[model samples]
Target: MGIHQMQSDLRAFARERDWEQFHSVKNLVMALSGEAGELSALLQWVEPGQIGAWIARPANREAASDEIADVLAYLLQVADGLDIDLEEAFTAKLAKNAAKYPVEKSRGVSTKYTELG
Candidate 1:
């Protein structure tokens, strides 16, 4: 259920299916993007308020979860391939975002960081 468990399961599934050979970082990244596109397509025409309901629909939720899993699987594979630590990357990104969007200038505002003055 945790990331480590999910990563192990994904690796095991790939090995069982002989898919590791085709799961290089580049290929996995491309597949991850494609899956993200599929997830995005599901909300393309839905209103903001309705999007939540659409996502909550059983079939839609299943599809969304599958796409999310695809993205996560590839991301973990990429980290494993490059020997990078996901926790470190996550922490670094959080710090970077914090610097980019200081609360004094960002709170209660929907504007982008670039527009904050």
Candidate 2:
């Protein structure tokens, strides 16, 4: 289903469970941060080159996937609460990023946009 539909379904799920009371945008954002941290922690200690192997383990992949889902759920809820269109927002932001980080200047480098020149 699409994001709006997913948000609607998620809202209904929360309403049915009476969990909506705790889903204020702030709370949802905090929960999202926690979930993201959990996902990050899953691969934080692995050497960059070994991250593939680390996540390739079935159990680890499952654990990371669960954390990712939690993160997305909370993020969707946050977008719903704020009435933000995630697809539109992402597209606009990506265009802005592309303008700021053009290939000729940004290729093969990690410098911040402000320092790209």
True-vs-predicted CA distance for residue 30, candidate 1, Å: 0.4
User: Candidate 1, clashing residue pairs?
Assistant: none
Q: Write the per-residue lDDT of candidate 2 for residues 6-117, one digit (tens) a residue.
A: 8999999999999989999999999999999999898888899998898889999999999998999999999999999999999999999999999999999999999998
Model 1, 1-117: lDDT tens digits are 776777788889999999999988888778878878887887789899897888879999888888887777778877877778888899999999999899999999888888887
lDDT of 2 at 60: 95
* Predicted model with the maximum lDDT: 2
TM-score of 1: 0.85
TM-score of each: 0.85, 0.94
Per the 3 Å backbone cut-off, how many clashing residue pairs does candidate 2 have? 0
